[model samples]
Target: MVAVAAALALGTNAGAQLYSTPAEVTANPLVKGFTVSGLTLSQGQTRVTLDLAGGRLVGLLVQGQGAQEVARGLVLAWGGEEKNVADLARSLGAEEVKAQARTAQGFAEDSEGTVLRLKVTGSGNAERWSAYTSLLIHPDSAFPTTANAEGNSKAPNVLRVFSDFQCPYCKRMWDTAHRTWAAQPNVYRVVHYHFPLEQHENAEPAAIASECAAAQGKFWPYADQLFSRVEDWVPQPNPTAKFVEYARALKLNVGTFQKCLTSAAPRTAVRAQYAAGLKVDVRGTPSVYLNGVQMQDYSDAEEAALIRTVTAASPSAAQVIEARLKALR
Candidate 1:
């Protein structure tokens, strides 16, 4: 049996009041195949722990103000694989909860403070087995500010990209998006957010490095270097040295960049961006939002066409004035 400690801290106001306990699992139809084993309400947070027949443990921590959930953390474990879950929870700034018996674990958070439904499935033999944990975070969370954006912020067409440095799909999407954006640089603003998946051990560090480079006005270049050389550093025992090498190559102030890596701010910012992505129901890397609306499964041709449509629909200064005059008529 593996012992795992999951911690989640929701920084509510000092005088925030605790809300009522969450409804029982039976009360929420969205939850299936799990039994609620424990529930607690304290310090403006509600915790629900669930147990499955195969000794799987699932814990949920929620912080709310009045009747609204403002933040939440979901943790799932089976045999002894709580390390990933624990690390993810800590990255998102959640408090710790203890558990035993583990197979594999997953952690997810919500910045919007809304209810989430997840599907948990598992099967095992006498030696070892695995399970699939699905998390559904509500889609009402506010989008985080883009710390690394290319093009004009006030542009009418905006593209928000949620991605992980270690995700191959994200890299593919980046390649496609880069080509498209290069062709129409003034048509849209592209904002990048970090959503590092737990399976990639080096992803978090890469995200931190990108954010650190952003502080020095080189986020795009640093990200390009990291993605271009992902295969080189991902397998290294520690990728920080490689990250430093990239910083030097970018002509960044190495001292300031290295200090940023050790500081909590960059990691914290990455986590916050991840939480925001979850709030908007981002389940995978390369999730894109056009003008605040999620766009799903589009081919590169379709994406380019959509971009052209947005660009065509955008009004020029003279067109804006003409439209205003017509509206006044």
Candidate 2:
């Protein structure tokens, strides 16, 4: 088995601090009557140890930390058939059994339980079959902030966005919020993270370029230009030149921007952000989170409503807008 250790740093809607450590389990200790079987020599298994309560898996237990329970939810993995998996979830108190698309992941929920399931198919008939399940006690806890994020760092309300520069939907969301909520730094803080889909060839390069621009304190504007003019450089043979052009237009030091682009720093930073997205179970581009709660429909209006809800007791909208406008200058 490939053994690797990493730390997962997380912050909540209430600004509570949390972190994750590598966890593993060789036995089915938490779930009673659950048996471990269907093992193949080649296809090994890795299970994250978790704590259960009231017929539902509640929190995870890391080595150094005492029972790091999830206030929102938990991700669980099970190896079995569809009916067996559903039955097990039901036994654990999951109510609705909504079967999603055959190839897509599925989810079922109850009053205080939500479970995300992904059916795993092994190589040929010689491999073992399994299903990975995420049992969310609090669904909102699944969304976390990126490490090197931008925007109002100290703002209580965090708008964590996982985006690809070349995604049309992402661009639409960005355009919708650019002038309103994103501009209002006092109402909500926007945190940017990279989720470059493999289909978008230029997306990763653009993400790296934006990180390089961030090194010069111009990530927001550079990202704006990237999304606004995606078609311009996306089809180019060497988009690095176009990135440089954008940097020059932004009045950034051309030499530094160019150097940062080719260097390992920007690439490493983008990779880390991508890893962070994966760790939080991001399925696609433009995955948005308002204060650690995943946004179902990513629209400017929806984002505004969430922000208002979080900061309801704070300053009025007009006052917040005025402060945001002043901060811009």
* Tens-digit lDDT track of model 1 for 53-121: 112112233332211121222322211122344443333332221111121233222222122222112
Model 2 lDDT per residue over 200-297, tens place: 99999999999899999898889989988989999997899999999999999999898898899888878877887786657898887665545556
Residue 242 Cα positional deviation in candidate 2, in Å, after optimal superposition: 0.6
List ranges where model 1 is wrong by over 4 Å: 1-141, 298-329
Instruction: Give the C-alpha miss distance for residue 220 in model 2, angstroms.
Output: 0.9
Instruction: In model 1, state the lDDT of residue 14.
Output: 10
lDDT of all the models against the reference?
0.54, 0.52
Evaluate residue 174 in candidate 1 and report its C-alpha lDDT on the 0 to 100 scale.
78
RMSD (CA, angstroms), candidate 1:
18.1
